[model samples]
Target: MKQPLKVAIVHDYLNQMGGAERVVGVLHRMFPEAPIYTTIADRRKLLPELQGADIRTTWMQSIPGILRRFKHFFWLYPFGVRSMDLRGYDLVISSSSAYAKGITVKGDTRHICYCHTPMRFAWDFATYMEGNEASPVLKAAARLLIKPLRWWDRATSARVHQLVANSTIVQERIQQHYGRSAPVIYPPVNVSRFEVSKEPPGDYLLVVSRLVSYKRIDLAVEACTRMGKRLIVIGDGPDRDRLKRLAGPTVQFLGRLPDGEVVRYMQHCEAFLFPGLEDFGITPLEINACGRPVVAYRGGGALDTVIPQVNGLFFSEQTVESLEHALRSLTHYAWDSAQIRKHAEQFSEEVFIRNLASLIEGQLSSRNPAARPAVPALAHKKKGAVL
Candidate 1:
């Protein structure tokens, strides 16, 4: 039997329990022996699955309060990721939305990037700074930093042997920004965690997301408020306070809740409100898995999962009026919960792992021209498999 290829996994950071962290968790499970490299890590904030992993952090980890304020150290992350010694590893896989893909490795070693998006801040400078109420001084500083950061982002794209995008939008962004092509691999959703509802849907609208500005949770709050619709807002972040102030009496802010409770809300809600544009939004599918339809913005990743009058309804614009119209249409139409759950099964954890493992095996086979990988079916097992 051939020995397993020496592998190393790198992630941008380990401070949030978000979609990116979940991807890292799945990768860790697939490569249990490989150590995870990151710029900074706060074990207390990570998911339980990642808490016990051998997560090695760089010198930046020693910075005070970096756990809560790592974004302030953005300029240092490129250097921090590149400085890690990954020379001996046969393969380096960086699960990144940002600088993690800049990890330096020998020419002979394979490096695959599961790019969520080519550093959103670097590429979408105007959009990234839009919702922030940063002081003029901070804005000026960011404007100056973006130039060098853009150069660094473009320069580092050449390091990856292969690039895997999470959605078609991200795949297109990679080609447009990096001048590179990548396959689209939808992020995994733990479909088994949610069950189809036994009863009919509840009266309230549901918004389960980090209370952040760009996420456009404000649209949901404002729309539901104007319409006098009861909306349950779950999850918390820096924008929590401002969101609370914008919310009307009908909108209830639940902050963050345990996964089980979140699933419970998904099962019972009238429809899941996904107001933001995501590279590949996983929450909408998670809601679908619980047999709930979604009212989503008709752009970005929502286009991939939601079919008009199928799994969910989509609003053409990212404004309160558009979302309100979609909500009205959602109420008038009947939804098929079983079909929605079935649609979600395509993006399950099992499917993501199988497709990903197949890609790794293929890359390894090409490198070792002398011997082809044993499992050919692994590559062709599923249709609609991208990267």
Candidate 2:
């Protein structure tokens, strides 16, 4: 009799809900029995889908105030991840943007890492810290840690048996930073949760994202404020105060809202605004699912998802002038909401699960040829070619 594979999942941490965490949620659904290991988890911040997950935390979880100040302990993550006991799992899948990929595995246990990107702080300290408002002393301390962290990050890239990238830009980054070639797998978006609105699009523009400096929410805030366009900004982070100060009378900040409320905003907005570069921006697809177009900066993952004049339009530069031009150009473009929504459906949750499962089964078959027949016929399936 063929035995079932013992699979376990590893994530950098479950301290916040975002696109990466959503990817973890899809993974949990795919391998429901798989135990999830992480450095720490903040229960209050867990998404609804992850509320009942079998999450196992490391020693870092017990540290006082770790949940609130996790970023301060970045240096300890490699040690915490390395300390995990993953000896028995037949397959260990790590969803990492950082230390989760550094876990130790031995013997026949194969490790597959779904890398969101190389550690940004270590690899691109200047841009990662650009517009960051940390104390000078703290910034100095972080700068000192970058060189050693980069070394450790590069050294650990060799630990994984296979790597998966979320977008083409990230795939290029993996090859550039880690000397590894990874197949691109577009992450899942729950297209069904959104519906094409029956009502006509509203006059106001919308932005839904974590207000971080690197994300450049200020671009959206400033562009709208300068144009006297009504812009609604949702989500919150350290960059809120500065962004609010940049806002004019027409710009509104709604902070964090429920998913349903967010969808309501997406359904009625003139268009969704994605001003920052992302590994993969899921919110734009969510808005597209709501039958709306996006106006995004032309770079990073946006290159993969945004089909110019089809689903969304793009600005060439990250500057206020470029974005302002795109906003001005938006009024002249004729947008087809149904076509936009159709494009988003290509990156649905079902497609992601099918592609990922096929990849996993193919790897398993390659590892044990004798058990090939016992696996599903999907072993020959290819990664997502949607891009």
**Judged by TM-score, which candidate is best?**
2
Candidate 2's residue-wise lDDT over 28-72, tens digit each? 887788899999999999989899999999999999988877877
lDDT of candidate 2 at residue 317, scale 0 to 100: 95
Give the TM-score (vs. native) of candidate 2: 0.93
- Cα RMSD (Å) between model 1 and the true structure? 3.1
Candidate 2 least-lDDT 10 residues: 372-381
TM-scores for every candidate against the unseen true structure? 0.92, 0.93
Which residue pairs collide, candidate 2? none
* Ten-residue region with minimum lDDT total, candidate 1: 370-379
Q: Evaluate residue 200 in candidate 1 and report its C-alpha lDDT on the 0 to 100 scale.
A: 86
* Residues 272-338 of candidate 1: C-alpha lDDT, one tens digit per residue: 9999988889999999999889999988988888888878998999999999999889867778889
Residue 268 lDDT, candidate 2, scale 0-100: 95
